[model samples]
Target: MVQKYQSPVRVYKFPFEMVMAAYEKRFPTCPLIPVFLGSEVLSESASADGSTHVIERSCKLSVDAPRLLKKIAGVECVFFIQKNTLSWRDRTLLIEAHNETFASRVTVLETCSYSVHPDNESWTCFEQCASLDIKSFFGFENTVEKIAMKQYTANIKRGKEVIEYYLSELMSEGITEIPRWVPPAERSSPSKAASPPAAPSSEMPAAALAHQSPRLQMVSWGPDKLDADYIERYLGRLTPMQESCLIQLRGWLQETHKVKIPKDEHILRFLRARDFHIEKAKEMLCQSLTWRKQFQVDYILETWKPPSGLEEYYAGGWHHHDREGRPLYVLRLGQMDTKGLVKALGEEALLRQVLSINEEGQKRCEENTKIFGRPITSWTCLVDLEGLNMRHLWRPGVKALLRIIEVVEANYPETLGRLLIVRAPRVFPVLWTLVSPFINENTRQKFLVYSGNNYQGSGGLIDYIDKEIIPDFLGGDCLCQVPEGGQVPKSYYLTEELENLDHIRLWAETIYQSAQVSKGAPHEIMIEIVESSSVITWDFDILKGDMVFNIFHSKRTPQAVKREVSSSVPAVNNEQLIDRSWVLGVDYSIVESPLTCREGESIQGSHITRWPGIYILQWRACGPTHARVDEVLSSLQGSAPKCKVMYYTEVLASHDFRGSMTSLESCHSRFSQISVTTTSSSQSQDGSLISR
Candidate 1:
């Protein structure tokens, strides 16, 4: 496996010319870097106008490896070829380097660039990326890769320090700036002549300038680049390699899942959860993203309203901040009647309540981060287990609790900063045994349990939470608004109401709808447009087999088909809107070109209606149309090829089209708009499968 690294943009509050001069001083030899032995120029060239310079050098470096490994490799030092291309006209420098020793066995490539900051003319920005590939290393490939990556990351900060040292040296010598390069003809012009340099007495101290905090340059990096200062200020500090993994994973998402990309803080959480393993983090994050989309989790705070019974009986609610500024949630688990609540509102209602709490907790965290002026990505939960007992561990309730734990662990990794359990009963151990295995190891370490009166004194709640804000029930003065849960009345039990509730239907109350597209019997919907030029927008994810999508406009409406329904099973609308006897062009004309969608791909697009009538959106399975009757019959008898799609569509008036366009563009849809002209046949648009 090849290892890669990317460094966030580092800004120097100095002109590009001065930064370039300091960078050049690092050549020949730099005592600050012990491993950098020396470098000799192989070739040098400059343009006639002195606006462009190119240099190639052979650098020698001592490898910091174990003695046994060095002896086995029969090498003490390695060589690398460094090439620099300086464009004074563009105010940029590009550096490329590659290892020379063991080129066939192991490959190391690095690229670095220094350019003028986009927003600040006086500032210079630096960025770097490198990759290491070890094909064969005498049965020590893994060890070599680990050692090489460790050394590389350890030197990342050192490289910046070296540049700062050179910069300080130059400043101490009264060289505060370097004149920009110019053509001979322009240099002679009085208007084009450079101004006199600033005096040394007017400049700040070199040491102070070198040690100052680096400012974040306000550059338009779009959504791809992550600023170092932003990361530190918003997502907390991360190692160089951790930052690289975050950037790489985010870049992959931007490339594949363009719509609804999670925030940087959210992405960082996944990276931390996986210990910065790119592939593992990517897999975990992709699964969570899909879950969020399928269940409409992103809008839970807005869409989910807990039942009145749950609001009054649920034992959990947000309180105040902990000592570390984390949002604190007080859950009176011991006092709450778990069995009564589950029996009253059903397990699905309880699960939805929990999800809403999590969503609200995350929002509170963001708000607290701004209020506290620090990064608060997780929250603290204080469980008042004074009333916990065997009744709380009822079989059905335990099963429901386990399911909730599994969902939260998989989707909300690393969100719990601390879990404080106070006044635990003797039976708490039994409950813990049933659920602790489902919790993540990282999260489990944050659990703090205190039984009996052990939580009152030092090294207890006071150490993590403020004394005054402790709930009144916990012997503190502050009053908590969390619902005082009790045994629900028998009249509230939803026995008959929940007996036939489908698990899938619990989360199916979303704006999106699912359809099954099979061979010949295509799934489609009809949209009635009363005004021309109105916008018809559609977003859908192909969840199964490959299928083709097309839009057709008809002057006449198709009759709705009424089918027999089974009371036990919910209906799946897979009806074909277009009749089989109707001809393609006569009955309905294709308004947009056909788009071939593959499994796991999400497609969003819009079309402006040229005429008012009916629009049919269709998804048909893709396969050979000439299969033999017997072969098709045999396949159908066994398992027919089918496609599943989750889709949502909306129509906007002509006046509303302009207002919604911004949102449509921001979604990064593959097909932003479709031309109204009809095509002879459908063609597949460029699309990528959702990353797993």
Candidate 2:
């Protein structure tokens, strides 16, 4: 402890612990410089630099030595305590006294690197330690309490004085350089070097939020140290796998409806790991939209809801990282909270999280007689009619479904309508009910008959495929008849069937180019005819999850060929009706939490998916919300450009596949959509591969 000095500008020293403690109590909200003991920027490996010769690394910095001292004399606004709770009146005298003697050439830097002013007792020790060249430094310790009766009065006084000192210094030099400390830039602040820059607020509404993608806000902390602050910034480029995943999502919902899109920010797209980092995956997503729409943004939306109290944000803060982080970069989506909803919905109806519909699914719990008779569901009845296209009808269907839920739920226990999950025909929800009970489930299958079909001329097609899709080889229909119960003629090509035959079709290099053109049939995935009309057979099971389509034509009769195959293979429910309940233009889901791919181990069943191939569609959410739908479309794009139907279902839990074993390449020739030989892991209990 230093003795009282006679001169003005007194200096004092206090324990670092005492300093921090006083500051927290004094300036709770005000940003104050930390007067830490032996505090220096940590090395990349978190190692301490041997800069501190005084404070020991064990408890705090060396008390008397240079443990916390890097400069001989640098001014800093740090917690100054004479020692062990000195009175404020005494501190004033000490500060005044110190300015008069024993020091020279002081350079006051930005923040306090170390407690800047040490009193005489500490000064003597510092001088002696340096003069005596004491490497194994030893000094007396003092338990001190740094106290400040008035809070912001202390830190604010310091900050203001520092500003005044700088302004005066500039005037003395007859020079002018704008000081960086002041808020001259703007209202928003930049995040850490590793974080996405937060966008500033816009003067207008949806001004910035309308055009920003949601992807910018997502910040992925690596599972290990490898994605550390320094490494990820440079090395984490989009991998090929990530690029492919993106390519698929870009095309998945080229025709989704806007109504089905989630209005809630959190429920939008996801930041996926394992398969590919969401950011890397989005690179391709952005380029995908460039091919379709002339106007597009570079960034996507990313939001993070910190565990309460960590971040000063609710529903988290929405900011766009790619679009020059500005208020113009933020996109706002409605927030959803389930807690207050049930009451607002009125107790007359039941609250449902999801709903399912199918012929068998309609009988889940006997309707009109069950406890909650006729459970509140999304649809009055799942419609299985013939109508518009899946690509075009998807959004309209969602709007219709939401409207149906809102309209009918008025009197019954179905008034609360928050979400609607769509799938082709009635199977999705039927498949949905057994898995999810909180949602509306229809066990008694019933659908309103819809005469929505307008396609009369060329089978189910509405018109000549758009110019964007018109194929080169297979336009004009050839009037050729096949014998009843015979195979389809070889001349008839089904592009979707071959391309999306299985996930392996992803191997086809030409697939990415599909975004620009429509398809006819797979010339690559074909079975040739022989001297004698040979029966080259393939079952629909191979193409069950319609990710790919199976278009086949034989010299003989497709009718005869199909009849023979029908006797041997049970048909998967491939979409037949045009009015099936599929979203066309817009489809989206609310992602309530960070999707846990790890928790997916509980699902025992693997539901059948007709769409075997995955495709992606990307669009800017509302505006500045950088949202790209990582949607899975019928990998059949190269197969059936005009097909009005598409379907998909995730059968196995993510862990079931040690790694994605989708033979997307061999999909063309093999009739099997799923390889029976491929095991979920090197060793699996179920031999889960679908046996053909």
Measured by TM-score, the strongest candidate is: 1
Report the alpha-carbon TM-score of model 2 versus the true structure. 0.17
- The alpha-carbon lDDT assigned to residue 418 of candidate 1 equals 95
* C-alpha TM-scores of all predictions: 0.83, 0.17
Error of 1 at 488 (Å): 2.1
- The model with the greatest lDDT is 1
lDDT string for model 1 (1-692, tens) is 55667778888889988876677676555677667776777888877766777878777777678898889999888887877778888988887777778878876667777899888999998888766666677887777766766767777767677778889989999989788766576677877776322211100111110111111121123356777778888888888888878888887777556656788889988888998898888778877876788788988888788878888888889998899999999999988888888888888888888888888888898898899888999999999988888999899999999999999988888899999999998999999999999989999999999999888779999999899898999988899999888878778887664744735558667778888766765677999988776777777877778888878888668874423345653445666566655777798887766787766566766766667789988888885422333443343333566678888889877577455544443443443434445222111221111111
**Per-candidate RMSD vs. true structure?**
7.2, 29.0
lDDT scores in order: 0.74, 0.21
Q: Cα deviation of 597 in candidate 2 (Å)?
A: 20
Q: Which segments of candidate 1 are over 4 A away from where they belong?
A: 188-223, 502-506, 515-535, 542-601, 609-644, 651-692
Model 2: residues with Cα > 4 Å off, grouped in runs = 1-40, 43-564, 572-692
